[model samples]
Target: MPDRILVPVDGSPLSKRALEVACDEYGTAEITALHVIDPTEPGYSIFGVEYDPSTAPRHGSEAWYERATELADELFEELDALADEHGVSIRTETVVGRPDREIISYATDEDVDQIIVGSHGRGEESRLLLGSVTEAVAFRAPVRVSLIR
Candidate 1:
Protein backbone atom coordinates (compact mmCIF):
# COMPACT_ATOMS: atom_id res chain seq x y z
CA MET A 1 0.00 0.00 0.00
CA PRO A 2 2.24 2.73 -1.22
CA ASP A 3 1.10 6.20 -0.32
CA ARG A 4 3.00 8.33 -2.81
CA ILE A 5 4.25 6.96 -6.12
CA LEU A 6 6.80 8.97 -8.07
CA VAL A 7 7.30 8.54 -11.77
CA PRO A 8 10.18 10.26 -13.49
CA VAL A 9 9.33 10.93 -17.11
CA ASP A 10 11.54 11.87 -20.04
CA GLY A 11 8.97 11.84 -22.85
CA SER A 12 10.07 8.39 -23.95
CA PRO A 13 7.66 5.61 -24.82
CA LEU A 14 9.00 3.64 -21.88
CA SER A 15 8.19 6.54 -19.58
CA LYS A 16 4.62 6.62 -20.84
CA ARG A 17 4.31 2.94 -20.16
CA ALA A 18 5.64 3.44 -16.66
CA LEU A 19 2.94 6.01 -15.99
CA GLU A 20 0.32 3.61 -17.20
CA VAL A 21 1.66 0.94 -14.88
CA ALA A 22 1.48 3.31 -11.93
CA CYS A 23 -2.09 4.24 -12.73
CA ASP A 24 -3.08 0.61 -13.05
CA GLU A 25 -1.26 -0.62 -9.95
CA TYR A 26 -1.62 2.30 -7.57
CA GLY A 27 -5.06 3.54 -8.40
CA THR A 28 -5.73 4.88 -4.92
CA ALA A 29 -2.36 6.43 -4.19
CA GLU A 30 -0.93 9.85 -4.93
CA ILE A 31 0.78 9.50 -8.29
CA THR A 32 3.26 12.17 -9.22
CA ALA A 33 4.94 12.84 -12.58
CA LEU A 34 8.42 14.30 -12.26
CA HIS A 35 10.38 15.80 -15.11
CA VAL A 36 14.02 16.58 -14.46
CA ILE A 37 15.53 19.48 -16.37
CA ASP A 38 19.03 18.27 -17.12
CA PRO A 39 20.97 21.29 -18.23
CA THR A 40 23.67 18.95 -19.43
CA GLU A 41 21.38 17.34 -21.98
CA PRO A 42 22.59 17.84 -25.53
CA GLY A 43 19.38 19.38 -26.80
CA TYR A 44 19.23 21.79 -23.89
CA SER A 45 22.97 22.24 -23.59
CA ILE A 46 24.19 25.78 -23.94
CA PHE A 47 27.41 24.53 -25.43
CA GLY A 48 28.06 21.76 -27.91
CA VAL A 49 29.14 19.41 -25.14
CA GLU A 50 27.19 18.11 -22.15
CA TYR A 51 30.21 17.36 -20.01
CA ASP A 52 29.50 20.20 -17.64
CA PRO A 53 26.54 22.51 -17.66
CA SER A 54 28.15 25.08 -15.38
CA THR A 55 30.83 25.79 -17.97
CA ALA A 56 28.56 25.60 -20.97
CA PRO A 57 28.52 28.62 -23.29
CA ARG A 58 26.40 31.26 -21.64
CA HIS A 59 25.29 28.50 -19.36
CA GLY A 60 23.75 30.76 -16.75
CA SER A 61 22.38 33.27 -19.23
CA GLU A 62 18.71 34.14 -19.13
CA ALA A 63 18.15 32.61 -22.55
CA TRP A 64 19.82 29.37 -21.56
CA TYR A 65 17.73 28.98 -18.43
CA GLU A 66 14.59 29.94 -20.33
CA ARG A 67 15.20 27.21 -22.87
CA ALA A 68 15.54 24.64 -20.09
CA THR A 69 12.31 25.79 -18.47
CA GLU A 70 10.56 25.69 -21.84
CA LEU A 71 11.58 22.12 -22.39
CA ALA A 72 10.37 21.14 -18.91
CA ASP A 73 7.04 22.85 -19.56
CA GLU A 74 6.53 20.93 -22.77
CA LEU A 75 7.16 17.63 -21.02
CA PHE A 76 4.79 18.58 -18.22
CA GLU A 77 2.05 19.45 -20.68
CA GLU A 78 2.43 16.13 -22.41
CA LEU A 79 2.40 14.27 -19.08
CA ASP A 80 -0.71 16.15 -18.04
CA ALA A 81 -2.47 15.17 -21.24
CA LEU A 82 -1.55 11.53 -20.77
CA ALA A 83 -2.75 11.56 -17.17
CA ASP A 84 -6.03 13.08 -18.30
CA GLU A 85 -6.48 10.33 -20.83
CA HIS A 86 -5.80 7.75 -18.15
CA GLY A 87 -8.43 9.35 -15.95
CA VAL A 88 -5.91 9.81 -13.16
CA SER A 89 -4.93 12.97 -11.37
CA ILE A 90 -1.16 13.40 -11.27
CA ARG A 91 0.92 15.93 -9.42
CA THR A 92 3.62 17.39 -11.66
CA GLU A 93 7.09 18.50 -10.61
CA THR A 94 10.17 19.98 -12.23
CA VAL A 95 13.76 20.06 -11.00
CA VAL A 96 17.04 21.18 -12.52
CA GLY A 97 19.93 18.73 -12.08
CA ARG A 98 21.22 15.32 -13.02
CA PRO A 99 18.14 13.18 -13.60
CA ASP A 100 19.08 10.30 -11.33
CA ARG A 101 20.30 12.44 -8.46
CA GLU A 102 17.33 14.76 -8.66
CA ILE A 103 14.86 11.94 -8.69
CA ILE A 104 16.50 10.15 -5.77
CA SER A 105 16.71 13.29 -3.70
CA TYR A 106 13.14 14.29 -4.40
CA ALA A 107 11.83 10.89 -3.42
CA THR A 108 13.65 11.10 -0.12
CA ASP A 109 12.83 14.72 0.62
CA GLU A 110 9.18 14.29 -0.19
CA ASP A 111 8.91 10.93 1.55
CA VAL A 112 7.66 9.13 -1.51
CA ASP A 113 6.54 5.59 -0.78
CA GLN A 114 7.45 4.19 -4.16
CA ILE A 115 8.98 5.08 -7.52
CA ILE A 116 7.80 3.70 -10.83
CA VAL A 117 10.24 4.17 -13.70
CA GLY A 118 10.73 3.08 -17.29
CA SER A 119 13.67 1.41 -18.95
CA HIS A 120 14.34 2.94 -22.36
CA GLY A 121 17.07 0.35 -22.93
CA ARG A 122 19.47 3.06 -24.07
CA GLY A 123 21.26 0.31 -26.03
CA GLU A 124 23.25 -2.51 -24.51
CA GLU A 125 26.64 -0.81 -24.77
CA SER A 126 25.44 2.34 -23.09
CA ARG A 127 23.64 0.41 -20.41
CA LEU A 128 26.80 -1.49 -19.65
CA LEU A 129 29.05 1.54 -19.66
CA LEU A 130 26.63 3.95 -17.99
CA GLY A 131 23.48 2.67 -16.38
CA SER A 132 20.19 4.32 -17.25
CA VAL A 133 18.25 6.53 -14.85
CA THR A 134 15.87 3.76 -13.95
CA GLU A 135 18.72 1.48 -12.98
CA ALA A 136 20.37 4.17 -10.94
CA VAL A 137 17.18 5.06 -9.11
CA ALA A 138 16.18 1.49 -8.54
CA PHE A 139 19.52 0.81 -6.94
CA ARG A 140 19.93 4.00 -4.96
CA ALA A 141 16.47 5.16 -4.00
CA PRO A 142 15.48 4.62 -0.41
CA VAL A 143 11.90 3.96 -1.38
CA ARG A 144 10.61 1.04 -3.34
CA VAL A 145 11.26 1.21 -7.10
CA SER A 146 9.16 -0.43 -9.78
CA LEU A 147 10.69 -0.48 -13.25
CA ILE A 148 8.54 -0.88 -16.36
CA ARG A 149 10.38 -1.77 -19.48
Candidate 2:
Protein backbone atom coordinates (compact mmCIF):
# COMPACT_ATOMS: atom_id res chain seq x y z
CA MET A 1 0.00 0.00 0.00
CA PRO A 2 3.00 2.30 0.27
CA ASP A 3 3.45 4.74 -2.55
CA ARG A 4 7.03 5.84 -2.02
CA ILE A 5 9.53 3.18 -0.92
CA LEU A 6 13.12 3.82 0.07
CA VAL A 7 15.66 1.06 -0.44
CA PRO A 8 19.15 1.79 0.76
CA VAL A 9 21.83 0.30 -1.47
CA ASP A 10 25.57 -0.29 -1.14
CA GLY A 11 26.22 -2.72 -4.01
CA SER A 12 26.08 -5.66 -1.60
CA PRO A 13 24.43 -8.87 -2.66
CA LEU A 14 22.06 -8.64 0.28
CA SER A 15 21.08 -5.09 -0.70
CA LYS A 16 20.57 -6.25 -4.27
CA ARG A 17 18.23 -8.89 -2.95
CA ALA A 18 16.30 -6.19 -1.13
CA LEU A 19 16.08 -4.32 -4.43
CA GLU A 20 14.68 -7.44 -6.00
CA VAL A 21 12.07 -7.56 -3.28
CA ALA A 22 11.20 -3.96 -3.92
CA CYS A 23 10.84 -4.60 -7.62
CA ASP A 24 8.64 -7.58 -6.96
CA GLU A 25 6.33 -6.00 -4.45
CA TYR A 26 6.28 -2.40 -5.52
CA GLY A 27 6.81 -2.69 -9.21
CA THR A 28 4.65 0.34 -9.80
CA ALA A 29 5.66 2.40 -6.79
CA GLU A 30 8.24 5.15 -6.59
CA ILE A 31 11.54 3.85 -5.26
CA THR A 32 14.51 5.76 -3.97
CA ALA A 33 17.91 4.14 -3.64
CA LEU A 34 20.30 5.74 -1.16
CA HIS A 35 23.99 5.04 -0.65
CA VAL A 36 25.71 6.72 2.28
CA ILE A 37 29.46 6.94 2.60
CA ASP A 38 30.54 6.47 6.21
CA PRO A 39 33.55 8.68 6.66
CA THR A 40 34.58 6.81 9.77
CA GLU A 41 35.30 3.66 7.83
CA PRO A 42 39.03 3.17 7.74
CA GLY A 43 38.94 2.15 4.12
CA TYR A 44 42.67 2.26 3.75
CA SER A 45 45.10 2.71 6.59
CA ILE A 46 48.80 2.05 6.22
CA PHE A 47 50.53 -0.82 8.06
CA GLY A 48 47.23 -1.92 9.56
CA VAL A 49 47.73 0.88 12.03
CA GLU A 50 44.52 0.87 13.96
CA TYR A 51 42.41 3.82 12.94
CA ASP A 52 42.86 6.57 15.48
CA PRO A 53 39.66 7.21 17.35
CA SER A 54 40.68 10.72 18.28
CA THR A 55 41.36 11.88 14.75
CA ALA A 56 39.46 9.75 12.30
CA PRO A 57 39.72 10.63 8.64
CA ARG A 58 36.77 12.73 7.58
CA HIS A 59 34.18 10.68 5.68
CA GLY A 60 34.58 12.78 2.56
CA SER A 61 38.32 13.08 2.38
CA GLU A 62 40.97 13.20 -0.32
CA ALA A 63 41.31 10.22 -2.63
CA TRP A 64 39.26 7.60 -0.82
CA TYR A 65 36.25 9.84 -0.38
CA GLU A 66 36.14 10.66 -4.06
CA ARG A 67 36.42 6.98 -4.91
CA ALA A 68 33.53 6.13 -2.64
CA THR A 69 31.38 8.90 -4.09
CA GLU A 70 32.14 7.80 -7.64
CA LEU A 71 31.22 4.25 -6.78
CA ALA A 72 27.95 5.36 -5.20
CA ASP A 73 27.10 7.32 -8.33
CA GLU A 74 27.78 4.29 -10.50
CA LEU A 75 25.61 2.07 -8.34
CA PHE A 76 22.76 4.52 -8.51
CA GLU A 77 23.13 4.76 -12.25
CA GLU A 78 22.68 1.02 -12.49
CA LEU A 79 19.65 1.21 -10.25
CA ASP A 80 18.21 3.96 -12.42
CA ALA A 81 18.55 1.76 -15.47
CA LEU A 82 16.77 -1.08 -13.70
CA ALA A 83 13.99 1.25 -12.68
CA ASP A 84 13.66 2.47 -16.21
CA GLU A 85 13.33 -1.08 -17.45
CA HIS A 86 10.59 -1.69 -14.91
CA GLY A 87 8.85 1.56 -15.77
CA VAL A 88 9.11 2.66 -12.13
CA SER A 89 10.24 6.11 -11.13
CA ILE A 90 13.48 6.00 -9.18
CA ARG A 91 15.54 8.53 -7.24
CA THR A 92 19.07 8.02 -5.97
CA GLU A 93 21.39 9.91 -3.63
CA THR A 94 24.89 9.66 -2.25
CA VAL A 95 25.23 11.17 1.19
CA VAL A 96 28.24 11.41 3.47
CA GLY A 97 27.86 10.45 7.12
CA ARG A 98 26.78 7.55 9.31
CA PRO A 99 24.73 5.21 7.20
CA ASP A 100 21.85 4.51 9.55
CA ARG A 101 21.37 8.06 10.77
CA GLU A 102 21.49 9.52 7.27
CA ILE A 103 19.07 6.92 5.98
CA ILE A 104 16.62 7.53 8.78
CA SER A 105 16.89 11.28 8.41
CA TYR A 106 16.36 11.11 4.66
CA ALA A 107 13.31 8.88 5.08
CA THR A 108 11.86 11.27 7.59
CA ASP A 109 12.55 14.32 5.44
CA GLU A 110 11.24 12.73 2.25
CA ASP A 111 8.19 11.29 3.97
CA VAL A 112 8.86 7.88 2.50
CA ASP A 113 6.04 5.48 3.13
CA GLN A 114 8.33 2.57 3.96
CA ILE A 115 11.94 1.42 4.09
CA ILE A 116 13.11 -1.95 2.85
CA VAL A 117 16.59 -2.81 4.07
CA GLY A 118 18.86 -5.83 3.90
CA SER A 119 20.73 -7.19 6.92
CA HIS A 120 24.37 -8.12 6.50
CA GLY A 121 25.05 -10.59 9.27
CA ARG A 122 28.07 -9.43 11.18
CA GLY A 123 28.33 -12.54 13.37
CA GLU A 124 27.74 -12.50 17.13
CA GLU A 125 30.97 -10.82 18.11
CA SER A 126 30.68 -7.96 15.63
CA ARG A 127 27.02 -7.43 16.46
CA LEU A 128 27.89 -7.25 20.16
CA LEU A 129 30.78 -4.90 19.47
CA LEU A 130 29.03 -2.53 17.07
CA GLY A 131 25.37 -3.43 16.97
CA SER A 132 23.40 -3.49 13.74
CA VAL A 133 22.56 -0.44 11.65
CA THR A 134 19.54 -2.20 10.20
CA GLU A 135 18.28 -2.93 13.67
CA ALA A 136 18.75 0.65 14.79
CA VAL A 137 16.95 1.98 11.74
CA ALA A 138 14.12 -0.47 12.20
CA PHE A 139 13.65 0.60 15.79
CA ARG A 140 13.96 4.36 15.29
CA ALA A 141 12.49 5.26 11.91
CA PRO A 142 9.21 7.16 12.09
CA VAL A 143 7.69 5.24 9.21
CA ARG A 144 7.30 1.55 8.48
CA VAL A 145 10.49 -0.49 8.05
CA SER A 146 10.86 -3.94 6.57
CA LEU A 147 14.16 -5.68 7.33
CA ILE A 148 15.00 -8.24 4.68
CA ARG A 149 17.28 -11.11 5.44
Candidate 3:
Protein backbone atom coordinates (compact mmCIF):
# COMPACT_ATOMS: atom_id res chain seq x y z
CA MET A 1 0.00 0.00 0.00
CA PRO A 2 1.14 3.53 -0.69
CA ASP A 3 2.10 5.87 2.10
CA ARG A 4 0.35 8.74 0.40
CA ILE A 5 -2.51 8.74 -2.07
CA LEU A 6 -4.00 11.43 -4.30
CA VAL A 7 -7.63 11.42 -5.36
CA PRO A 8 -8.86 13.98 -7.85
CA VAL A 9 -12.52 14.83 -7.36
CA ASP A 10 -14.86 16.93 -9.50
CA GLY A 11 -18.23 16.57 -7.81
CA SER A 12 -19.09 13.74 -10.17
CA PRO A 13 -20.49 10.35 -9.20
CA LEU A 14 -17.53 8.53 -10.71
CA SER A 15 -15.13 10.75 -8.83
CA LYS A 16 -17.03 10.11 -5.64
CA ARG A 17 -16.77 6.40 -6.29
CA ALA A 18 -13.05 6.74 -6.82
CA LEU A 19 -12.76 8.52 -3.49
CA GLU A 20 -14.71 5.76 -1.83
CA VAL A 21 -12.37 3.20 -3.31
CA ALA A 22 -9.38 5.07 -2.03
CA CYS A 23 -10.85 5.36 1.42
CA ASP A 24 -11.91 1.75 1.54
CA GLU A 25 -8.75 0.27 0.07
CA TYR A 26 -6.15 2.70 1.31
CA GLY A 27 -7.76 4.36 4.27
CA THR A 28 -4.60 4.16 6.32
CA ALA A 29 -2.63 6.14 3.80
CA GLU A 30 -2.53 9.88 3.73
CA ILE A 31 -5.12 10.94 1.19
CA THR A 32 -5.50 14.26 -0.50
CA ALA A 33 -8.63 15.12 -2.44
CA LEU A 34 -7.92 17.51 -5.29
CA HIS A 35 -10.45 19.52 -7.27
CA VAL A 36 -9.28 21.25 -10.42
CA ILE A 37 -11.20 24.22 -11.72
CA ASP A 38 -10.80 24.29 -15.49
CA PRO A 39 -10.45 27.85 -16.62
CA THR A 40 -10.97 26.89 -20.25
CA GLU A 41 -14.52 25.96 -19.44
CA PRO A 42 -15.47 28.68 -17.04
CA GLY A 43 -19.10 27.88 -17.63
CA TYR A 44 -18.69 24.30 -16.44
CA SER A 45 -21.42 23.54 -13.95
CA ILE A 46 -20.42 21.40 -11.01
CA PHE A 47 -23.89 21.40 -9.52
CA GLY A 48 -25.61 20.13 -12.64
CA VAL A 49 -27.33 23.49 -13.03
CA GLU A 50 -27.88 24.62 -16.57
CA TYR A 51 -25.74 27.54 -17.59
CA ASP A 52 -27.68 30.75 -18.08
CA PRO A 53 -25.55 33.42 -19.67
CA SER A 54 -28.18 35.98 -18.79
CA THR A 55 -27.61 35.56 -15.03
CA ALA A 56 -24.34 33.68 -14.86
CA PRO A 57 -21.16 35.53 -14.00
CA ARG A 58 -18.90 36.38 -16.91
CA HIS A 59 -16.03 33.96 -17.54
CA GLY A 60 -12.69 35.00 -16.01
CA SER A 61 -14.32 37.71 -13.96
CA GLU A 62 -13.75 38.07 -10.21
CA ALA A 63 -17.30 36.96 -9.63
CA TRP A 64 -16.65 33.83 -11.62
CA TYR A 65 -13.60 32.92 -9.57
CA GLU A 66 -15.51 33.48 -6.36
CA ARG A 67 -18.30 31.30 -7.61
CA ALA A 68 -15.84 28.61 -8.55
CA THR A 69 -14.29 28.77 -5.10
CA GLU A 70 -17.69 28.45 -3.52
CA LEU A 71 -18.49 25.42 -5.62
CA ALA A 72 -15.17 23.83 -4.71
CA ASP A 73 -15.94 24.40 -1.06
CA GLU A 74 -19.28 22.69 -1.41
CA LEU A 75 -17.66 19.73 -3.12
CA PHE A 76 -15.06 19.43 -0.40
CA GLU A 77 -17.72 19.45 2.25
CA GLU A 78 -19.48 16.51 0.65
CA LEU A 79 -16.25 14.64 0.10
CA ASP A 80 -15.21 15.25 3.69
CA ALA A 81 -18.42 13.77 4.91
CA LEU A 82 -17.88 10.73 2.78
CA ALA A 83 -14.36 10.28 4.10
CA ASP A 84 -15.60 10.61 7.64
CA GLU A 85 -18.12 7.89 6.99
CA HIS A 86 -15.30 5.67 5.85
CA GLY A 87 -13.34 6.40 8.99
CA VAL A 88 -10.66 8.21 7.07
CA SER A 89 -9.26 11.73 6.99
CA ILE A 90 -8.25 13.55 3.85
CA ARG A 91 -6.63 16.83 2.92
CA THR A 92 -8.50 18.83 0.27
CA GLU A 93 -7.06 21.19 -2.30
CA THR A 94 -8.45 23.28 -5.14
CA VAL A 95 -6.38 24.48 -8.06
CA VAL A 96 -7.21 26.40 -11.23
CA GLY A 97 -6.00 24.83 -14.46
CA ARG A 98 -6.54 21.91 -16.78
CA PRO A 99 -7.50 18.92 -14.63
CA ASP A 100 -4.98 16.52 -16.12
CA ARG A 101 -2.02 18.84 -15.90
CA GLU A 102 -2.80 20.08 -12.43
CA ILE A 103 -3.41 16.59 -11.09
CA ILE A 104 -0.12 15.29 -12.44
CA SER A 105 1.75 18.33 -11.22
CA TYR A 106 0.26 18.04 -7.77
CA ALA A 107 1.08 14.37 -7.46
CA THR A 108 4.66 14.88 -8.58
CA ASP A 109 5.20 17.97 -6.47
CA GLU A 110 3.56 16.57 -3.39
CA ASP A 111 5.40 13.25 -3.59
CA VAL A 112 2.19 11.28 -3.69
CA ASP A 113 2.79 7.56 -3.88
CA GLN A 114 -0.37 6.70 -5.74
CA ILE A 115 -3.27 8.39 -7.53
CA ILE A 116 -6.90 7.26 -7.50
CA VAL A 117 -9.18 9.06 -9.93
CA GLY A 118 -12.43 8.54 -11.80
CA SER A 119 -12.41 6.95 -15.23
CA HIS A 120 -14.63 9.77 -16.48
CA GLY A 121 -15.39 13.23 -15.22
CA ARG A 122 -18.53 15.37 -15.38
CA GLY A 123 -17.72 16.81 -18.81
CA GLU A 124 -18.06 14.01 -21.32
CA GLU A 125 -18.19 16.28 -24.34
CA SER A 126 -15.18 18.18 -23.14
CA ARG A 127 -13.38 14.89 -22.54
CA LEU A 128 -14.16 13.89 -26.10
CA LEU A 129 -12.73 17.18 -27.28
CA LEU A 130 -9.70 17.57 -25.00
CA GLY A 131 -8.89 13.92 -24.17
CA SER A 132 -9.44 11.98 -20.95
CA VAL A 133 -7.89 13.48 -17.86
CA THR A 134 -7.69 10.06 -16.25
CA GLU A 135 -5.82 8.63 -19.22
CA ALA A 136 -3.44 11.56 -19.30
CA VAL A 137 -2.62 11.32 -15.62
CA ALA A 138 -2.24 7.54 -15.73
CA PHE A 139 0.24 7.79 -18.57
CA ARG A 140 2.16 10.83 -17.38
CA ALA A 141 2.19 10.56 -13.63
CA PRO A 142 5.44 9.40 -12.02
CA VAL A 143 3.55 7.32 -9.47
CA ARG A 144 1.06 4.53 -9.84
CA VAL A 145 -2.52 5.41 -10.80
CA SER A 146 -5.75 3.52 -10.25
CA LEU A 147 -8.89 4.39 -12.20
CA ILE A 148 -12.36 3.80 -10.79
CA ARG A 149 -15.12 3.57 -13.33
Candidate 4:
Protein backbone atom coordinates (compact mmCIF):
# COMPACT_ATOMS: atom_id res chain seq x y z
CA MET A 1 0.00 0.00 0.00
CA PRO A 2 2.58 2.55 -1.04
CA ASP A 3 1.36 6.05 -1.71
CA ARG A 4 4.70 7.58 -2.60
CA ILE A 5 7.58 5.76 -4.26
CA LEU A 6 11.08 7.18 -4.53
CA VAL A 7 13.37 6.13 -7.31
CA PRO A 8 16.95 7.33 -7.53
CA VAL A 9 18.39 7.53 -11.02
CA ASP A 10 22.00 7.95 -12.11
CA GLY A 11 21.66 7.56 -15.88
CA SER A 12 22.49 3.86 -15.68
CA PRO A 13 20.81 0.82 -17.14
CA LEU A 14 20.06 -0.60 -13.73
CA SER A 15 18.47 2.66 -12.64
CA LYS A 16 16.21 2.55 -15.66
CA ARG A 17 15.25 -0.99 -14.77
CA ALA A 18 14.40 0.14 -11.28
CA LEU A 19 12.29 2.96 -12.69
CA GLU A 20 10.34 0.55 -14.83
CA VAL A 21 9.77 -1.77 -11.91
CA ALA A 22 8.62 1.12 -9.73
CA CYS A 23 6.15 2.38 -12.29
CA ASP A 24 4.71 -1.09 -12.79
CA GLU A 25 4.51 -1.81 -9.11
CA TYR A 26 3.01 1.48 -8.07
CA GLY A 27 0.82 2.21 -11.03
CA THR A 28 -1.47 4.75 -9.40
CA ALA A 29 0.86 6.16 -6.77
CA GLU A 30 3.14 9.14 -6.88
CA ILE A 31 6.64 8.41 -8.17
CA THR A 32 9.58 10.69 -7.52
CA ALA A 33 12.85 10.36 -9.42
CA LEU A 34 15.79 11.82 -7.54
CA HIS A 35 19.27 12.39 -8.88
CA VAL A 36 22.10 13.17 -6.55
CA ILE A 37 25.34 14.82 -7.68
CA ASP A 38 28.02 14.11 -5.15
CA PRO A 39 30.23 17.15 -4.75
CA THR A 40 32.84 15.10 -2.90
CA GLU A 41 33.47 12.79 -5.86
CA PRO A 42 37.14 13.12 -6.73
CA GLY A 43 36.92 12.58 -10.48
CA TYR A 44 40.51 13.82 -10.65
CA SER A 45 42.42 10.96 -9.03
CA ILE A 46 42.08 7.87 -11.19
CA PHE A 47 44.68 5.22 -10.51
CA GLY A 48 44.76 3.69 -13.98
CA VAL A 49 43.81 6.58 -16.24
CA GLU A 50 45.73 9.82 -16.58
CA TYR A 51 44.41 12.39 -14.10
CA ASP A 52 43.51 15.76 -15.58
CA PRO A 53 42.77 18.42 -13.01
CA SER A 54 41.75 20.89 -15.71
CA THR A 55 39.06 18.54 -17.02
CA ALA A 56 37.51 18.13 -13.59
CA PRO A 57 34.72 20.59 -12.85
CA ARG A 58 35.23 22.69 -9.75
CA HIS A 59 32.34 22.26 -7.31
CA GLY A 60 32.34 25.89 -6.17
CA SER A 61 32.03 27.42 -9.62
CA GLU A 62 28.61 28.56 -10.82
CA ALA A 63 29.23 27.13 -14.29
CA TRP A 64 30.04 23.70 -12.87
CA TYR A 65 26.94 23.65 -10.68
CA GLU A 66 24.75 24.85 -13.54
CA ARG A 67 26.00 22.16 -15.89
CA ALA A 68 25.41 19.48 -13.31
CA THR A 69 21.94 20.83 -12.63
CA GLU A 70 21.07 20.77 -16.32
CA LEU A 71 22.25 17.20 -16.69
CA ALA A 72 20.17 16.05 -13.74
CA ASP A 73 17.18 17.96 -15.02
CA GLU A 74 17.42 16.27 -18.40
CA LEU A 75 17.54 12.85 -16.79
CA PHE A 76 14.51 13.63 -14.64
CA GLU A 77 12.65 14.99 -17.62
CA GLU A 78 13.13 11.73 -19.47
CA LEU A 79 11.90 9.78 -16.49
CA ASP A 80 8.97 12.14 -16.03
CA ALA A 81 7.98 11.72 -19.67
CA LEU A 82 8.08 7.95 -19.39
CA ALA A 83 6.01 8.05 -16.25
CA ASP A 84 3.52 10.29 -17.95
CA GLU A 85 3.22 7.82 -20.82
CA HIS A 86 2.40 5.15 -18.28
CA GLY A 87 -0.27 7.37 -16.72
CA VAL A 88 1.63 7.78 -13.46
CA SER A 89 2.28 11.08 -11.77
CA ILE A 90 5.98 11.68 -11.18
CA ARG A 91 8.01 14.43 -9.55
CA THR A 92 11.68 15.22 -10.02
CA GLU A 93 14.33 16.39 -7.59
CA THR A 94 18.05 17.03 -7.68
CA VAL A 95 20.22 17.18 -4.59
CA VAL A 96 23.92 17.83 -3.92
CA GLY A 97 25.90 15.65 -1.51
CA ARG A 98 26.88 12.00 -1.07
CA PRO A 99 24.34 9.72 -2.72
CA ASP A 100 23.78 7.34 0.18
CA ARG A 101 23.29 9.99 2.83
CA GLU A 102 21.17 12.24 0.67
CA ILE A 103 18.86 9.42 -0.35
CA ILE A 104 18.40 8.16 3.17
CA SER A 105 17.77 11.64 4.51
CA TYR A 106 15.23 12.40 1.79
CA ALA A 107 13.24 9.22 2.44
CA THR A 108 13.19 9.94 6.16
CA ASP A 109 12.25 13.58 5.80
CA GLU A 110 9.64 13.08 3.11
CA ASP A 111 6.51 10.95 3.26
CA VAL A 112 7.96 8.35 0.94
CA ASP A 113 6.34 4.95 1.54
CA GLN A 114 8.72 2.91 -0.57
CA ILE A 115 12.06 3.23 -2.38
CA ILE A 116 12.92 1.41 -5.58
CA VAL A 117 16.64 1.54 -6.42
CA GLY A 118 19.45 -0.27 -8.12
CA SER A 119 21.83 -2.30 -6.03
CA HIS A 120 24.89 -0.80 -7.76
CA GLY A 121 25.51 2.45 -9.55
CA ARG A 122 28.53 3.56 -11.64
CA GLY A 123 31.09 2.49 -9.04
CA GLU A 124 31.19 -1.26 -9.54
CA GLU A 125 34.21 -2.27 -7.47
CA SER A 126 33.68 0.37 -4.83
CA ARG A 127 30.07 -0.69 -4.46
CA LEU A 128 31.08 -4.33 -4.06
CA LEU A 129 33.59 -3.47 -1.36
CA LEU A 130 31.94 -0.56 0.51
CA GLY A 131 28.31 -1.38 -0.22
CA SER A 132 25.99 0.89 -2.22
CA VAL A 133 23.39 3.62 -1.80
CA THR A 134 20.72 0.95 -2.07
CA GLU A 135 22.16 -0.99 0.82
CA ALA A 136 22.45 2.13 2.98
CA VAL A 137 18.86 3.09 2.26
CA ALA A 138 17.58 -0.44 2.85
CA PHE A 139 19.09 -0.60 6.30
CA ARG A 140 18.21 2.90 7.47
CA ALA A 141 15.04 3.86 5.64
CA PRO A 142 11.96 4.26 7.77
CA VAL A 143 9.86 2.76 4.96
CA ARG A 144 10.05 -0.30 2.76
CA VAL A 145 12.77 -0.58 0.10
CA SER A 146 12.85 -2.58 -3.12
CA LEU A 147 16.33 -3.05 -4.65
CA ILE A 148 16.58 -3.81 -8.36
CA ARG A 149 19.80 -4.97 -9.95
lDDT of 2: 0.76
Task: Quote each prediction's TM-score.
Answer: 0.81, 0.78, 0.89, 0.81
- Backbone clash total for model 2 is 1
Superposition-based RMSD of candidate 4 using all C-alpha atoms, in angstroms: 4.6
lDDT string, candidate 3, 1-149, tens digits: 79999999878788899899999999999999998888888575364646677898998888888888888899899999999999999999999999899999999899999999877644655635223788899889999998786
**lDDT over C-alpha atoms for residue 6 of model 2:** 90
For candidate 2, write residues 91-119 as lDDT tens digits.
Answer: 78788788899999999999899999887
Q: For candidate 4, write residues 19-116 as lDDT tens digits.
A: 88888878888888888887776431111223245874665566667767777777778787877777777788888888888888888788889999
Higher lDDT: candidate 1 or 4?
A: 1
Number of the candidate with higher TM-score, 3 or 4: 3
For 31-131, candidate 1 gives per-residue lDDT tens digits of 99888877675456121223345654465567777776776677778777877787888998888899899999999999999999887566765635324
- State, as a TM-score between 0 and 1, how close model 3 is to the true structure: 0.89
Question: Which parts of model 1 are misplaced by more than 4 Å?
Answer: 45-60, 122-131
Least accurate 10 contiguous residues by lDDT in model 3: 122-131
* Each model's lDDT: 0.78, 0.76, 0.86, 0.75
Model 4 scores a TM of 0.81
